[model samples]
Target: MTDRFAAFRALHHGDRPLLLPNAWDHASAAALAARGHPAIGTTSLGVAAAAGLPDGEAATRAETLHLARRLRGLPALLTVDVEAGFSDEPAEVAALAAELAGLGVVGINIEDGRPDGSLAPPALTAAAVAAVKDTTPEIFVNARTDAWWLGVADPLGQALERARLYRAAGADGIFAPGVSDSDTIGVLVAGLDAPLNVLHRPGGPTVAELGRLGVARISTGSLLFRAALGAALATADALRAADPAPGAAYPEPPSYVEVQRLSAPPGAG
Candidate 1:
């Protein structure tokens, strides 16, 4: 367990940034593991929407834990996104982290953003991070700040301040999502003590560019899940518009047997 935790932590210190693909379920995680990703994360939005719950409101704690349990046996390291730790109480959040750690989860992403478009006070957020670290020292807590996401005034200053607070509170990594500008990204990467994480945006800096700017981790938060949804809708539309032909050629979709294989454990009958 210590070795697994160490390996997951080491991924953030490589020559290039670790590109973490967020998975919503077992199949998504298994597929990514098969594709040779060293680590995988859960997107809170995907988890919430799949469970028919609202995101960022601490509504999917059960759903997130269930997904983590399902993904425990995968080859890649698993890190869960427990949005704001799913409770304001730090001890409750620590208990949740301990549960996840017992299930072979090596890390978690906890943010400081509230559903009502406000930031949790920095000290409060720090306490949550501290509690999780105090309870489970092996679990890498990726502290996330939403200054840019919430369009706060002076986002750079706010993110920097929060990053410092989170780092002081023992965060292993700092995630500033929605911070796409190169200058701001560079500033955070240079200023932060822990590994810096940036959200990957389509039209923003490419992974290579972010790597060049010294980002230690690049998370595709909710992007792949959203892309999967978009592709499914487009495929359905394409099938509806196509003329019925005996040998019509369309994009080859993964077969049912192939998808079923994703659920099977290695060496299982």
Candidate 2:
């Protein structure tokens, strides 16, 4: 609840949407910060996959905390995706939020989607949002309702209803992913009192288009991680096939020395 928190909160109100790139590990986070992203988010899928766990099952609390500890030293604001807060209990979720806030985290994404393909009850989600705000008022809480993501009937109606409850319970922003249409995004931006965040799709709409539709924040959730994985597999396949120009499809990676420098401790060589 200081400059970092305020700065992160302020990003949502910028003239353009705050383009937040989600990272899986320290290297990705550090690399994005070095590339001039003022804020970075943790992709729940990426984190769980990296730890050999499943995402949205509340299974990666320890892994998330460990990564947060490692990322505390990065030169950027941090927002963690605590998938459903790793627990349905309000106090438990709030405690996790407080812990992340203490570790220099500025924000968190708490989604209502469950592992079993159901959305949490609006009351449960609201209680968690309220508890987190009570525990750490300064941390930005981007409450996520996965109505569209889970493909529920009346997705927009369900999302708006749940978002209202979360906002009333003290959520700072409302994120409804999987709704990529411009008209729908505009309705969300116009309907909600809090900032509306959307997920970035490669061919759906550009960042500028989202901004034009009044999106406050745009997140690349798991896109970078999946891309990196695909690139690695493609490179391996090319080499196995003895094909020429195997590296042409991917961007050039950082030099070995550059990576070593990035991984070094503050005073270490």
Per-candidate alpha-carbon RMSD to the true structure: 1.9, 1.0
Q: State the weakest 10-residue window (summed lDDT) of model 2.
A: 260-269
| Backbone clashes, each candidate | 0, 0
> In model 1, where do residues sit more than 4 Å from their true spots?
243-251
Which residue pairs in model 1 clash with each other? Answer: none
Candidate 2 lDDT, 88-189, residue by residue in tens: 899999999999999999999999998889999999999999999999999999999999999999999999999999999999999999999999998888
Note the residue pairs that clash in candidate 2. none
Tens-digit per-residue lDDT, 1-269, candidate 1: 49999999999999999999999988999999989999999999999999999999999999999999899889999999999999999999999999999999999999999999999999999999999999999999999999999999999999999999999999999999999989888888889999999999999999999999999999999999998998787777766878465134445667899899999987687
Best by TM-score: 2
**Model 2 lDDT at residue 92:** 97
